[model samples]
Target: MPAPPRNILASTDLHDVRWLRSSYSTGANNCVETARPRSGPETGLLAVRDSKNPAGPALLFSAGSWAGFLTAL
Candidate 1:
């Protein structure tokens, strides 16, 4: 009923997530990483973070928004 959680102050806060990289990405790690939190406040939402900074803040998006973003791309 309430809005989903927003930016995570530190990626480390998501202890249960498994960040995934795109297969199309190069080994340089320049792409953004995405994860779906299986537990905690972020569960069922998408978590995105820059590969260049693993410990940096992560932004969260709802499933509908994520799908729309991919469709828009």
Candidate 2:
């Protein structure tokens, strides 16, 4: 899939981005947090990372690519 737009990507203020964890993780605490840029102009990118490692690196993906990746899992 194509990469996310450069402008949104460059301006990704990860510190302020809200993240969501999988409910499927249950009480294990082994889940990742994710955020999708607000809908409309910046809706193509998806940000994800390990909840336990908030300061660690995050993985970004184009919307389509992210859907495909999730489907494969």
Candidate 3:
């Protein structure tokens, strides 16, 4: 299959996705939030968005790409 798009126009475009923030996040919504699309074209892809802008666009990454990003940190 072809690769998924690099991003979605808006996080709202993803349905039924449960956004999650790191446990290390403070009360301030400064950290990024992540979610996995359980259905639709984005299924199996990781979605990330700014916590402060839930309605903003989201960056989509494959599982391996997401893992490598975290491993490098």
Among these predictions, the greatest TM-score belongs to 3
The candidate, 2 or 3, that scores higher on lDDT is: 3
* Candidate 1 Cα outliers beyond 4 Å, as residue runs: none
What's the TM-score of every candidate structure?
A: 0.93, 0.66, 0.94
* Stretches > 4 Å off in candidate 3: none
Residue 53 lDDT in model 2?
66
lDDT values, one for every candidate: 0.93, 0.66, 0.94
Give a tens-digit lDDT track for model 1, residues 2-65: 7779889898899878999999999998999999999987998999999999999999999999
Tell me the tens digit of each residue's lDDT in model 3 across 9-38. Answer: 899999999999999999899999999999
Give per-residue lDDT, candidate 1, residue 9. Answer: 86
Better of 1 and 2 by lDDT: 1
Model 2, span 27-57: residue lDDT tens: 6668877887666444647777776766666
